[model samples]
Target chain A: MSGDIVIEAKGLTKTYGQAVAVDHISFTVGRGEIFGLLGPNGAGKTTTILMLLGLTDISGGQVSVLGFNPAREPLSVKRRVGYLPDTVGFYDQLTAADNLRYTARLIGFRLAEREKRIGEALDRVGLSEFAEHRVGTFSRGMRQRLGLAEILMKGAQIAILDEPTSGLDPHATAELLTIIRRFKTEGVSVLLSSHLLERVQSVCDRVALFSAGRIALMGSVSDLGREVLGSGYVVDIEAEGSGLGERLALVPGVNRVEQTGIGKLRLHADRDVRPEAAAEVVAQHGRLKFLGVQEPSLEAIYTHYFAARPDGTLKEGARHAA
Target chain B: MRREGSAFNGLGVVMLKELADHLTSIRFIILEIIVMLIAVGTVYVATQQIKDTVAQDPFLFLKFFTTSRAPLPSFIFWLSLLVPVMAIGLAFDSVNGEYNRRTLSRILSQPIYRDALLFGKFLAGLMTLAIALLVLWLLVIGLGLLFIGIPPGGEEVARAFVFLLVTLIYAGVWLALGLLFSIVFRSAATAALATLGLWLFFYVIWPVLAGEISQIIVPPDPRYMALGLQTPGTVVLEQFLARLSPSTLFGEIVVAILDPTTRALGPIYLSQLQGAVLGAPLPLGASVLIAWPQIVGLIATSIILFVIGYVVFQRQEVRA
Candidate 1:
């Protein structure tokens, strides 16, 4: 992806009376990048999305989407940006084609062009067969897909999706993520918010971890794992041997070793100790079952950051990333 | 911050969608059927009564709307009462229903401004009411021509046209009221109930309360009090207070336009009737002049209520 900023928010803040929904936070989304906003419920993710769409007024700071101020030029901004809200409601009484037609008209598409675009959008979202069916009869997954079709029909340059997979099963979630990736392939800048760390990690190029209306950590997933977990590699060894932890701890470059199971031992080392450790295991005459390095999962990094404080704030040493 | 150019960019699309929905919905169809049946039945009974009592009357065609049979009210009375019912039915759930279904934010996210949605809904509701009223008017006139065996005079037709226009304006008042309540109340059921309650109060209970309040404010003269003879001041005050309700204003206009012999809507001095022939019909323009304030009153109330709905809707946050 080219390094061109499509969305920029500087010191963005939102306040409802005395309650600060979003504190001063700044971020930029580059074109053709999938940026995730990771936060738990009430962590100001949806509030931030609304502020970016100009659906809600910003209490302070500024937001620019595609070089237009959302608050001042919302029509101009809305014309180029598509938003799929958390609920993703449609006119249930109308057929899918009729619902899309209403939006097409709102976007000022000409009569001859509207039909062609609607057909293409339906086909893109795999909803062409259900075009004539009433939306009331549609399942949740079908509705979500139709919402994506609406965004495609608008020919939007940016899409802001708020919890696009909140209520979906694993199958539907995977399907939606695939479609979202397709959007990236089409060069559309996407900003998706979710509390599902694994899903976000699987799809996002970069993420900003939100904690109590503040970004506690922001970086690529691998970088964040390294930053939080430190420069250490976890090696898991399953061998039918006695005194494995004692023998593994004496190896060079090994920081700590612990027996995790009846015949399993995990060793933490500053570097790859697999080669020497294998030799030591063979000399000790232990039968090795399995030996591999375990990369830190996003779950581990998320737990590390959240477990550091009751309020989900990062500790002083990790605050530099914020 | 007003945007340049038209604030009505997407108005036609929104309006067309709403109109199509209203026309095809069962609610509107049921209302139209009920009203049409009652109107045709009332006119049929009135035609029979007119044939028996005034077969040779010069202005017999006017009786189709103004004549009251033994057990049935006149056509105008049914219209004044049921037209508001239809208007309220169409609009009571308009704004809140969108919120309940969670479509408000989705629709607002489009390129249009908030002004288009509310304005478009109002216009759509008004247009539906207009179409229904026009059809009913034609049906009544057709029935009159068939049963009465004579076409109405030019003056009678003109007066009837004015009456229909005024009735539409009256319906617009209730449409605006329902839309305002829909914006104020979140639940569709609550908005519908509130609209019906207000309709009941204005149509049935307000006139009695106005009468009592007028009596307290301007009691009858002591000499005529025992005979239930109200003073002119009491009568005028009561009339003024009753006209505050749109139903009362509509009733006054109906009486003035449908029955051209109505010389005045308020207390008429005997001197004002000097040299006037009894039972003579007033000119069509004169009848309109007499009901001018009631017409203006209906139109102004509709505008004021619509403005309230517009302001509330524009200020509302899109998040459901």
Candidate 2:
């Protein structure tokens, strides 16, 4: 909302007869921002992405990509925004380069420009050595890289990736996240949907948690954690001390202090109370052994937000939707 | 709502890419071998027999396609079946193969309409069929010139060219049928089976069914049959029902185009034939005139099939 909005959905909805797949969800993706759509498998993330790309019809409401109506001016929207579908596949019989060549032709790039762009894209993804290999022989991670390379080759202003790291190993997921971060650095808006919240948390700047065809929560990780978990900061105090818990409770911004074990305490605060708590611990003649603050992860935020509602109704709803 | 840009923007690229794939595929190579045997092998044997027993025949060169030795039907007989087989073989997997490969969604997500992909595939299949047919036609012509020393007349060339063109249209009909089934069914094997099943129904089953249906419709007039003359309208109804199959329509067209003496495609009354000279070959134009309705039927059927495919593809979801 602060910067140029690349994707703006106004109550975008999709239905199959009586069942609604995406139920009037609205969100805006700012330029050069990594926006994550995090939820379980049937949370309508992929459906939302498809509606934004105009690959599927919006049964109600509307969406726009780069200021062009996706339902009406789909070609213009598709021209500037590259989409990497979930479990993306290519012609297995064709070589990697030949596959890219076919896409380049579809993008209407001339011969000379196509080859050069393909070379650069493949090299950028570190797939230059495998350009001549048949796509049937590509590993899962390599295929994802190639999908990303396609978005890069398109020179798109926005990239929509669905489940980019679903089947990848930890090392591969790390590498993929690096390339995604590079997209943000290069000023390309990234709108990615995934169920793997923990792995993708490091890359996404803002995220929407979906459940049963609706967004349950939408904001940055820490903001949602604060609103849901009552306090966003969790600081650990490891020191040789006495009466530190009672003393640390009076520190500014520190909400409360608990004695975990002998001479150890955990502090929940509205903000970073590590500095104030440390000062207070030392003021009581305690020798500080160690101190650290845990970064709020999306996984904790997602589970805590959903679990806070009594009766486990949303979880049951999510399971039925799946 | 109006979608932006031309639907035909990437039509040529998809057409060329698919064309290249078809021509280089192993399936096409097998088809090409069968075609060589059917076109060249059949024509060569027929030429040997035609040369040995030649009388004062005016349209002798046209006989290259019509003449048959024992144990082999005329080239026209095999061709009516071969053209459809080749066309179906080329197109049965055209749409569903993309779905199975998971490439259809990716291509559709590009800056092109669904029309370009479907139309390009149909065009590419037609072009590939044309190329194979052209090569087969040339080989048969070469065999004719090699075996039969005398050169064919100008009218003979015109008539043979017309047969080639009709065969292409005939190929288009089956290609469209296969294309339609490819879109209707999501699996390539299922689409192939469905198209082949329909082809078989038309090729073998319908002709017999047509006769039975026509008999039920007109009831084979016993009063007229007592005089040893066939009943009127009965034969017409049978032919009409039979020609519903594109195979029958194509066969009739080939008969009129290749055999100049084919005076009619349907039943003819003795009174209607009384004024015509016996054993006289009609001009190429007259023969075409006789086959005009069947030719138009073949063309219309192909167009209808292709339009159905286009509509279904447009409404389909891009994801597999």
Top-lDDT structure, candidate number:
1
TM-score of chain A of each: 0.84, 0.93
True contacts kept of each: 0.63, 0.79
Query: Candidate 1 on B90-143: residue-level lDDT in tens?
Result: 999999999988888888888888889888999999999999999999999999
lDDT of the candidates, in the order given? 0.88, 0.88
- What DockQ do you compute for every candidate structure? 0.59, 0.75
Question: What CAPRI grade goes to candidate 1?
Answer: medium
TM-scores, each model vs. reference = 0.91, 0.96
lDDT tens digits, residue span A1-322, model 1: 4779999999999887767778998999999999999988878898899889888888999889999888888889888998998878889999999999999998899998999999999999899999999999998988888999999999999988988888898988888899999999999999999988787688898899887787888888877888898857888898877777788899999999987888899999988899978987887889998899876677888888778665555432243244
TM match of model 1 to true structure: 0.91
How far in Å is the alpha carbon of B94 misplaced in model 2? 1.6
Candidate 2 whole-model C-alpha lDDT, 0 to 1:
0.88
lDDT of 2 by residue, A245-287 (tens): 8888888878878888777799998899888888888889999
